[model samples]
Target: MAGSSHYIMPRAEFDDAPKLLIVISPYYKDIADNLLAGAKAEIEAAGGTHEVIEVPGALEIPTAIGIAERMSNFDGYVALGCVIRGETTHYETVCNDSSRAIQLLGLQGLCIGNGILTVETQKQAEVRADVNDQNKGGGAAAAALHLIALARKWSVARKGVGFTNDILMAGKTDGSSTA
Candidate 1:
């Protein structure tokens, strides 16, 4: 696996410049900076604009994105952070919970690129965060951009996924019951 290569998808396209929010946990300053750089470069390459918000730790990244999704106009989000394994179970908790929250947000229709790195050592984090190397941050950004493109491609004007007001009031409006 050392000399293996993988397929990389081309940058995503947008009808209008998509706005993205980059939520980063700068606990590991150097790693976080590298991740941010990669994410920003990828977003700009895709003709998208971005705003960055810094949180205290990896666990907070998802919360910040959730808040932005509800109160802002961002089309997507990039989550950046490094969680190097430590002696305590805190590492596992942080990794699992943060990832779960991000996935939940994505399931709720928020386009999110999860770049939080959970590694055994700082060296691993560095390699993955490096813009010239693995560039996991860039990969995350690409994922979000792809989702955004898909959402836009299938976007339609509709009431939602359930019963409409018309259906709910059908018989009530005339004070009658079908049965």
Candidate 2:
């Protein structure tokens, strides 16, 4: 798959495989299942283990991941869902808010892959979710894995600037020695 035309980056490899959390919304049950299949297969291929959790709908997916990031120790997250347009404006709200939330969480140093599909028709969603087609789910999983690898690479960052006077005693706000 080495082609300059595609310009795809090489897959990230890890010595210590990371654990991942998949937060999916099953509002569109069949579509969600297909997405999950692709995502799980991709995570497995990357030598990573994952836990899947279903949110009520697309709007809840990012919220669930945010909770997991605070309360759990998952190395990364994959977000999957399908938002098919309807007659109401609710579709836009769900699509925009969920995506914005996911992006915000990623900015907060959480490795996340956003796979929520917002489409005008079920046909569009199906094509994107299909494993043998666009395989957006698998693409999302791959993105998360790559981010995790990058996180691991930078986990050793040290920005400390201190000396003897900067050392603080236990429970002390000021940099003062108890002795």
The model with the greatest lDDT is: 1
What TM-score, to 2 decimals, does candidate 2 have? 0.85
- What would the per-residue lDDT of candidate 1 be over residues 14-61, giving only the tens digit for each residue? 879999999999999999999999999999999999999999999999
Model 2's alpha-carbon lDDT is 0.91
Please identify model 1 stretches exceeding 4 Å from their true place: 156-179
Task: lDDT for model 1, please.
Answer: 0.93
lDDT values, one for every candidate: 0.93, 0.91
Model 2 residue runs over 4 Å out of place are 1-6, 157-179
TM-score of each: 0.87, 0.85
Instruction: Give per-residue CA lDDT, model 2, range 35-144, as digits (tens).
Output: 99999999998899999999899999989999999999999999999999999999999999999999999999999999999999999999989999878899899999
